[model samples]
Target: MPELNRRALLIGGAALPTATSLTPASANAPNNDEAFWREIAAEYDVTREIVQLENGNWGATPRPVQADYFEKLARVNRDTSYYSRRGMGRDLMAVRDRLAEALGVPSDEIAFTRNATEAMKTLIGGYNRLTPGDAVLYADLDYDSMQDCMKRMALRERAEVVRIALPEPATKASLIAAYAEAFARYPRLRLVLLTHVSHRTGLALPVREIAALAREKGIDVIVDAAHSWRQLDFSLPDLDCDFVGLNGHKWLAAPLGVGIVHIRKSALSKIDHDLATAPDGPDQIGERVHTGTLNAAAFLTVPAALAFEARIGLDRKSQRLRALRDRWVVRARSIAGVQVLTPDEPGLYGAITAFRIAGKTSMRDNGAIARQLLERHRIFTVARDGVERGACIRVTPNLFNTMAEMDLLAEALTELGV
Candidate 1:
């Protein structure tokens, strides 16, 4: 579609800028806050045909990153040997270092993975300690992939898979108590997986408290920051967890295939997952290099994403997202038979929200509702799975998303009479 428009303009007028017009002179013009984000959004090329509210799944990368990613691919294709031998590994790693610096963690403490799933599997799959009756505790709301991995370990090692429900209208204390209760149920609990921000309902859990409590019980914690990285503000040192994993493309606005893992230096020796060795060699911590070749462009463009964030600032972005979310909540809760499953507590939720109609259908039926919303209203959303609640519609918005989009969603959802 961008190409079609580009061609149309060429036929009658000056062609649309192919991101080449974004010179320093242009970027330096006036106050950058609004213009910066607007420029980034303009690059996304999201069609007017649908309102995308499911960024918890994945977000289309920004134009700068997309262009950079394609450039890296072209570079590789341009000269395979020169790119592979020298230009690929170390040069690309400078970008990784920059990513680590942005996260406030040491570069050596960071490693790239294919996605959050790979990071989770690498961090826990070779945990190196699991006795019979040993346990891995998790909430009912943890992502199905992580839970599935835990259950697989349960089947193979005779380990206990302790599950507990998160308290609704969650508070830091309530979330702490929830994990405590689950820990109390299993005497030999050895690990606890906490989703820093739940994918289904977009609840940003209190990771610091949860990790501190788990530490008291001598349990290892691996925080899934899949949504937390961009959806909420987080600092690694403050959380004090053993490991953290995140998806770069979903919320971070980086090119796809750039995921992150941070293993506390002390804990690296204890973790023995198989990944490619970084050029520095295996004796070093954060020496992880994925075996397969990866693109340097998307990984490099992380700096562009961060620069864009610096322009908008996390606080202002959070304000915009929360305001959008609160608007949806007001519209959703007003409808009869609608029950918000996620907490309405401002701190507990970011840009994500979910609600079910009373006795209308289970959360599993959410996919049906989501499909209907899309087919009928051109609103794109996702239905969550693998929970006691039947199904739930998950909504997330990026910086590009506007209140107008939310209004469209609200009108369409209210029309469902749910």
Candidate 2:
């Protein structure tokens, strides 16, 4: 591992500035749009050994953010006592406030966690009001760990857990109707778990509509927005939910081990304070998750990542990713034995999409396909299970990915008869 020295990087003009100072070149300039995005991609030092198409799992920190992370880590390691006692607390809170502002939410409503999994676990496990016979609902597309947490909550509360498999070739109406049926079937449903975007198939759910329906049915929803927050062109409020779990590393391009938990002001009472910090009171969102000591460097580097994203603008990033996905998906669909898991409708997906070879429903089969893609084509992808229909190869392209790379993948899939 390399340690960064702020003096060297800053003096060399390679260091990125603060969010207030960094501004992207005007998009109005003609014929330079692609050039500008390529400039953004240049900030990363990815290798050519393999083309990475599994960025949905964890987005590697770009050069600028990694520099900041290293600098912060070195600083913390050098002056551990002083920074921990006299400096870290204030800086951490400042990061929180900046992040909250960027998300268009209240600062007090958000708290930092290790990742979306821990944030979600804190939310699901600490929600203590369920009683015997109360029901909770979750879909097959929900993250596996979150579904397990819901099941544990059900067990602890002596409640019934309702699990449904989302319909294939899902449409906006069909997605919403599935939740509606779940609510109707289980009238006692008190809490529902919704994934803003499905990790298995890259299907972006209609969270706002589903949240509203849950509210109408007297159900409080805990949203797993780990994949959607930065990948999509929206904010927390857009989902119309009181609780959400987000990942900074996935699309915000932050260092790993960074995630967020948001609890609305009015909904604070629904979650029980974490046992480790129970005495701190339930009003503060931080009390909901008692993470003792974490990698302070990762959280400290968040501002740089946010500044980079802010410079590019979320909407533009989203559009670029959608175009990349469309580039490959549109071509891949022409091949035989190919099934695109994500719907072809607008606003239902972004860069993430999955594909399957006909009748390949087993994990081993999907894994073999992913291996072949990597070994034969030098294209890296991952196999995802838990989709009711079958396992699929998830393809995620980041900002650094080029259309040529997607063309290579299309060629590979076509060659494989998929």
Candidate 3:
């Protein structure tokens, strides 16, 4: 087994409350609006200057969660004996269980991983358990990490990888049928790795029906929920995938070094026990994934982040993100010759949106657009210059951003005529 490198200091010198005696700004009720977010904004100490639109890249830890994490860390450092002797792993899981409750899944189904990449890699790497000649299916629109892992499987395990292009700015039926056709063609495909939401185009995959259909085909599915958790309000039962890899840092706004992997209870029977010897309860999924000596601080603080979202609530955050996307899209699309690559329908995208900009009709033009945005505008966004869409820009919005900031982005694109 490769040694898992420990994480940077997630815990520092700070004080944590005895228990989370969480207080609402107003104990009786909370208002869900820009004002509410502003009040709670102090919880996360963002860097001094710059509008951060890259939560999709890395999330800054909130003040309360970071402080609590560091305080526990200091306590552990003070008496390594006291911390190590008492079985700290047993204690930390009560925290994860609380997160499980908030996520609407049973405690036994979720496991902790550092990020979605690790979680997805583990699932793809373990193809040794799969039947011979079993295939893996994905798309050109997926995060490159999973696509690369699939390539590795082909090299090592002799499994075939089938890649499909999501219909440009797809509809629910077309998206579902795209995968259905792939599965029907390759009945030997034992597993499907689908993104609940695309990291690249901000496209939302129709997972529920897809999951049901795959089950009928005897192909287990693993969902990448990097952009889905807290982006919308729904339960694990709703999407119904066999396995899911979630990033707390993205939408949940948790501190870094924490991610959750939930294996649907029905699919639990297929995973081998003793995968890792990390401590967990009798039926807890933590035991299945826990590698020794990880920072449990991020895992513990997720509830705080979720609590923050709960105060603002999921529906409102989602609406806010959609509204923000709409604002940016309208501005960008208004520029002559610009094409909004992301779907306008509410179901197709959220939190992230991408647009094809007018330029030299090449990927290089896309790269130039991204570089110009950052160098000139001080606005940060992800850009891609690959395959179908030559030059494109990805815009993402979070709770902390304001309309004025997005207007600035609009102004930058307007100057460029793209």
- Candidate 2, residue 242: how far the Cα is off, in Å: 1.0
lDDT of 1: 0.73
Candidate 3 stretches greater than 4 Å from native: 1-33, 40-43, 127-129, 273-287, 359-363, 385-388
For 1-418, candidate 3 gives per-residue lDDT tens digits of 1222101111122221232333555332343343344444445565424555665776666666677667777777787767667866676678678878877888778878888887777666654456558788878777888889877876676777788877876788888899889889997887788888877778888889988888899888878888887786667878877678888877777777777788777666565455665335465455446555666656666666766666656777687788767777788877876677787776778878777765555666766777788777666776754435454677787755655667777787776773
**lDDT against the true structure, each candidate:** 0.73, 0.86, 0.70
Off by over 4 Å in 1: 1-40, 273-281, 286-289, 361-364
Q: How do the residues 312-382 of candidate 2 rate in per-residue lDDT, one tens digit apiece?
A: 77888898889889989999999998889899888799999999999898999999999999888778999
lDDT of 1 by residue, 195-308 (tens): 988887788788888788778888889888888886777668867887888888887777787788888788887676465554346554455435366655667677777776
The TM-score ranking, best first, is 2, 1, 3
Question: What is the lDDT, from 0 to 100, of the residue 48 in candidate 3?
Answer: 28
Clashes of 3: 3
TM-score, candidate number 1: 0.87
